[model samples]
Target: KHRWAMYIDVSKCYGCYACVAACAAENNVPIGVFRTWIERHVTKGGTVIFVPKQCNHCENAPCVKACPTGATYKRTEDGLVLVNDDLCIGCGACIQACPYGARFFNPVKGVVDKCTFCEHRIYQGKLPACVETCPTGARVFGDLNDPESPVSQLVKKMPTSRLKEWTGAEPMIFYRDLPSEADL
Candidate 1:
């Protein structure tokens, strides 16, 4: 079984927003909402840091538990946090539960929506939209179970950090060389 994970090398990112555009286009994301977005932080020393934000696909997802209708759930096979449009009630519980602010109610569909790591494309042997369009190759995706996978190898070599680690969601997105402080 392949456990999917994403590794981001922040040092390689240049805040081009190419990944953001690519993700929106590929996912058909609506305006005023983002399946993936980038946050720019300027340190005290004036160095700019770009932190790309998306669904963490948490191992202990609060959104999954908060969804009253069981619309939000994590896949046991690959740990992808997915929304079932049929089951969603637009209650906004998932949105409120998510600390990462990665989900939203799609008014067009009357259901909650969020990032799935482009699992459809992954099944077709393609990278996620964000990863594919990253000009600097800052994004990496692979099976964490595979020792030779880039994500796995990066975790071994890099000092990685996850967003809100104290919350214990066990976020699968790992960042290398990330700024210690992230601003919205």
Candidate 2:
């Protein structure tokens, strides 16, 4: 499987939100339900900062294993997490099962919705909308398994983190910056 990874350089990101808009427009993500979203971990006495986040597509993905139906699955070839809309029952079990809160139930589609790493764009050998449109050049995407990929190089060069490391999800998304508490 291709090692998929996203690197977010927090230092470069200044909460501009171009990535958020791009994800919404490119994927037609619903208003209330987002395939990709941001989580601002504010800290340092109201000194707020933003971190754009989405599915990490973990190696041990709970969202996939918890689906009572065979709707959520990871592609063994590309390391992409996908939800089979046809197989989804809208049970919402996978929604709660996700440690990252990445899964959203789409009432219109009657299935779970989350970032598919821009599968449509990936198929065309294009960057994910979020990464491509980030005006600050904060987001980088590549195959982590490939040692020479840009993502892998950045990860090796900087300090990075994934949320909820204790859960052991092995999230592929990485953050180079984070907010300090007290701003919260």
Candidate 3:
């Protein structure tokens, strides 16, 4: 089984919003919301850091549990958390349950929506728009279950962190070289 995952090298990010734009264009995300976005943080010493934020596609996703209509679910095969629009009631339960604030109520669709790690493209053997558009090569996406995958190798060899670890959501998105002072 393929376990899809992403590795973000914080040290390589330069605050470019190419990922953001690509995600919007690829997913047809509404004007005011995003599936993936970049956050700019400055430490006390005034050093700027860019952190990319998106759905972690957690192993224990709160959004999956929170959806009353069974619209949100985690796919066991690839471990991708996805929303079933036909089942979605646009109740915003998943939005509130997401610790990473990755889910959004799509005004256009009237349903909760978020990153699918570009599932359509991935299954077609293409990279996610965010990963492909990243000029800095900061984002790496692959099957974590594959020993030879880049994501697997990076996680094995690099120091990494996931957001809101205490929540026990078991987020799959990993950040390499994340500064301690970035305030999550």
Which number leads on lDDT? Answer: 3
Q: How much lDDT does candidate 1 score?
A: 0.88
TM-score order of candidates, top first: 3, 1, 2
lDDT of 2 by residue, 1-184 (tens): 5888899876677777788888989977778888776666666566566777789899889888889888899889989989998888899888898888888977677678999999888779999999999988889999988899999999999888877877877888988875543112
Whole-model lDDT, model 2? 0.82
Candidate 2's C-alpha runs over 4 A off are 180-184
Distance from true location, Cα of 120 in model 3, Å: 0.2
Which window of ten consecutive residues has the lowest lDDT sum in model 3? Answer: 175-184
TM-score of every model? 0.96, 0.92, 0.97
Tens digits of per-residue lDDT for model 3, 26-124? 999999999998888887778899999999999999999999988899898889999999999888988899888898988899888899999999999
Local distance difference test scores for all models? 0.88, 0.82, 0.92
What would the per-residue lDDT of candidate 1 be over residues 72-155, giving only the tens digit for each residue? 889998889899888887899889999899998777777889999999999999999999999898999998999999999989
